[model samples]
Target: MITPDLSGKEFKLFQDFILENSGIFLDINREDSLRISLFSRITAKGFRDYYEYYSFLRYDALGEEEFKELLSLITINETYFFRNPSHFKFLKEYILTPLISERALYGKGIKIWSAGCSTGEEPYSMAITILEVFGFYKNLNIEILATDVSLKALDKAKKGIYSLHSLKLIDEKIKNKYFVPVDKNRFKLKDKVKEIVKFEYFNLIKEPYPLIEMGGWDIIFCRNVTIYFKIESIIRVIHNFYNSLKNDGYFFIGYAETLQQISSEFLPFKWNDIFIYKKEMRDLSLEEKDVNEKETGITEKKIERKSFNKAILSRGLYSKAMKFFEQKDFSQALRKVREVLEIDPQMAEAHFLAGKIHADSHRFVEAVESCQWAIQLVPLFLAAHFFLGVVYDKMGQPQEAINEFRKVIYIDGDFGLAYFNIARIYQLQGEDEKSLKEYTNAIKIFQKSSSEKALEFSEEITSELLIQTCRQNIERIKGFINKKNE
Candidate 1:
């Protein structure tokens, strides 16, 4: 449906309200488009202005149904089947196969959550992927929780109907076997496929996640959800995801996502084209040994392991350096990180920490040098590449930024922020279409990476903040390119 336009004040009011309630920061320049979309809902509600609609939404003794209605109006639900195929491809190879093998070994079931199910295609797709993987293991108990805020959509999903267009590239046999003819041009998922999935309503932003408390899940698919959330909201939701997973459980996000900046507990590993996060498992063996020693009356001395000590010292120095840098104490931060290097020359963390301080202080040469050193210390240091990308971006070398971001993705395919950076650079270079693709990719990754467990360890990604902190960069690039052409 075509949305109606709103007046400037109406646009601002609506934007502010959404930002406050949903933590979705609408770009000021998107006022007109946002106004059109938001105004459509007001019109649908038979309201005259946004203020009235906002008042109604806010003061209607807000409840689940009301919030779901609001979310239905606000959430963008544009999605396609097997859209971004590489992520699913990776899932088939690296993630699903491994999980199936593990489930067989342990004689346990597998559980998956499609956090933003959106009319059921994504979750259905996930179930299909699992089915394809465990074709022989038919007795295995596998289930998918397909949840979304739109009950209306969920209603449609429960009907298990879809247009043929949405089934592009699906194997003929799988389609024939899994879906039964419903009408002239539609199909309903077969009972077998439908039985494996449970449809429900869920809101990522506000949650005591519905099913997570009942049991920990093996994998979560939350792709493309976080692009709409504000930074703080994104962190909160991600932390929630982290807490929801079992130990060593995997979280699958979009091809363009990463948790390196968002959560510390999640250890992101890239296989093929997808970024999956594994929750850190505590070393129960050591704890058990300590308990045993205590019971046996053995004095188990906790010796100061050099590697452990060095990590502690390095982290402390890195923390102090961050504070110094925040206070604009470049020299001191640099000195502190150098001391960290002295303690452990091979510390990539120290190198990255040093690189950040140098980059922030406008010491491009030093920043580049430090970043390069970090990259050399550990070529897979995604943060170092991100920092280097920032340095290049600041130095007015969009191409360089693009290169550095690409390198980051090469090292870690799910590096969402790097995709964001690449998108920004492409936008700067007048590649608006490409930039949009990259931005969407980044958003996709961010959404998929979200989990209850991830949310607990999720913190503000300083690099993301720095990268998106200003609106001036886009305008600056626009003018630069325009003038260059003239």
Candidate 2:
């Protein structure tokens, strides 16, 4: 039997249904992908058309089971061992190193949850990282819980078997240590690694989290999962994750994902080149106090409340500056930001805001200086680097601008606007191939983002606009390449 085509109206109906049931937002750009997945299921069920399948899934008694099948087919389960090595490195060095020492003092156990852990690679990677760092000491109690919405992925994870493709990043030594060769192309994870991780079916949007009642988690990893979720659903899920975390607990999202505009409860912390969020900032302050006392004999008890009052005053001034900046009142914005800087000279945010004001006022030199100051204060400040690139571009220093954008990418590889800007510069320079590649990269990121979500650091550009522009640029670049070849 021939597969019936999915109409535009039918696509929207299914889109709403999916979002309502699973909290996954299926954008217009993903209609083709959704159609492809639907075709097979439609055929398997011997349905006449897309509408019939949709109705059956929505109304039939077996609808729940069919929906699960649809989820298995549509939900992306692509993962590899040690997919993002920096995250694991940060876990070992910055988090676990200090954590184990602190917990050892208190005789406490460490709990880590890998949310949306597909095929067990991520949670297993955490297991290996923990084992490498602290070993299996009797005193060190560590619990690893991995959960996913897709039962198909969880089943595969529980089996502890993986293909060579999934183990591509693993070194020979690590492969030898943690995995046993099942065949030429398949490997079975050693029991030691598999036993530590407990895999479960968890719907982030639908399920009530019981783990929080058990004294909360020390760490949670929910990487590359929320890209498919609606904005409201994302907010709900993130709020749940926040509650499930203990005071000062660490939370890691996908490198591409951000908590900007979603939640402010977690403080963003950059460790080396990796960025993670912490539930409480007070712990960092206390940790810093301990370090300072070790180096210069400064006691935490000696810290004054006056400094805290100054911080509060500066924050109020910064808010006023941000309002002025948003209104495009550059002079007032500059004055307020300066007041903020006077109160807290080391406030990187104030400096960054000042840079924006200077840039808007066409004072390129001052803009560069302000952005540089912000970078000096916080080396991994992404917004500072991004703004510096914009200032360089305005100054007609494309090379310098490209360098700054590359720095932003080095810090956060999934920054789409950086790729978009780089692509535009390449297009202007007539580097068709490079421009096309960068445009494609930008599209990949922006497509995953919500269509209506306003991009960070941009005045008003949304993900939908970026995706459209990138597609147009890619097509133009391809056309230029074809003409040159002819």
Query: What are the lDDT scores of the predictions, listed in order?
Result: 0.68, 0.81
Q: Report the lDDT of model 1 for residue 188.
A: 83
* RMSD of each predicted structure: 22.1, 20.1
Give per-candidate clash totals.
26, 0
Predicted candidate 1 versus true structure: per-residue lDDT over 146-187, tens digit per residue? 988777778877888988876775777767757777887788
Task: Write down the RMSD of candidate 1 (Cα, Å).
Answer: 22.1
In candidate 2, position 372 carries an lDDT of 92
What's the TM for model 2?
A: 0.56
**Model 2: per-residue lDDT, tens digit, 1-486?**
445567778889999998888888988888888988899888888988887788899999999888888887778888988887889977875567446645644558789999999899999999888756533323356789999878899999999899999999999977876788899999999876888899987778785784778769999999999999989999989999998999768899987889999998786765456678877534447678789789877454334323434654776687789899999988999999999888878777688889989988889999999999977776656667888998999999998999999987775666788888999998999988888889888888777532111165565787878899999888888888889899
